[model samples]
Target: MSAPFVKEIPTLLSLIQCADSLVKNPLTKESPFSVRVAWFDDAAKTQTALLTHYPRLVKESFYTEFEDTVQAGISLLNFQPFWSIMLGVETSQSSAAAESSATMPDSSPIVIPSVAGKDSPPEKSAIR
Candidate 1:
């Protein structure tokens, strides 16, 4: 897949951050599997690395889609100012890279991961 354009880098970065946060703290926490799957669909489209396998997208094909989408969070973390470094994306970053380590066909894909910063507001402020 081609690198994301420089113009879209910041938005991509934000998506990456949100993806990570969602994986750890999903808004879908109380939702059912169907809703979570729909959430994954929407989230994956916003970033390039996840969208790499778009042509293969099948409705309700959850496993491959999950791996590909979640891996995007880990994939681009290998390159910051990601649009620049990802132009020559490392081989390990591809979802296909997980194939070789497969214990069974399409079973347990491995991610070789190798990033930077974020901040959030405090709930309370100090009065001086």
Candidate 2:
């Protein structure tokens, strides 16, 4: 599959679910700008993310009108648990690692970990 990204899908999707943006993007062309927070541990192995953003540089999305033509060979509802776990990556893959079924929140509030790659933007401490 092509490595196409919807800008900041994970971050924007999460933030869109949360409260309003702390600082809206002034030149917001797409109307959606997000953050990639990083997760780190001191001596205690405690995870944390701090959201910060600044106009970096402009680049083109290879898939401005990307589409998925593949049909669902199977229903994913039964795989929700597994998908939850995969999406969680609770044990490894630092950035691609968070929001497990156990850690997934159901209201209240919680800090989200950064699961992006080392080179990618950090993860935002988000709540949904």
Candidate 3:
């Protein structure tokens, strides 16, 4: 008799743990603003399916709390539950300047909207 196939999906907590490390560690020491993530799923078909569709589930599970934190202007890194699974990361002014110049052409300055006000001057901020 042939053995039945089995698949395993990592729990949300496991994914969160993995994500935590990615966020904590910068892609390069010189570029503390950048993070590297490998978007690969488990080898198992069923597990891969779950990971492929996990973004929605993650949002559904944490959207409310995420919204609250944003409204309060609190850093997601400080939020224990969502720290590892944060959609994005914050950047410092110096890091932003360095990254922008490195990635963009010098023809024109890139205009980024300010959170304080639409008319306010552009400033470095988190990329979420």
Query: Where does candidate 3 have its weakest 10-residue lDDT segment?
Result: 36-45
* TM-score of each model, paired residue for residue: 0.26, 0.18, 0.26
Provide the overall lDDT of each model, using Cα atoms, as 2-decimal numbers.
0.40, 0.25, 0.34
lDDT per residue for candidate 3 within 1-128, as digits (tens), equals 01111112334445444544433432332332222122111112212333343545434434333334332322322333443333322223323444555564444433433336767787753223
Per-residue C-alpha lDDT of model 1 across residues 6-69, encoded as one tens digit per residue: 2222343354455455555443335676765554444544333435433233333343444455
lDDT of 1 at 55: 28
- Which tens-of-lDDT digit does each residue in 65-85 have in candidate 2? 110100010121232344345
Give the local distance difference test score of model 2: 0.25
C-alpha lDDT of residue 31 in model 1: 60
Query: Which runs of model 3 end up more than 4 angstroms from their true locations?
Result: 1-6, 29-53, 57-128
lDDT of 3: 0.34
Residue 112, model 1: Cα distance from true site in angstroms: 26
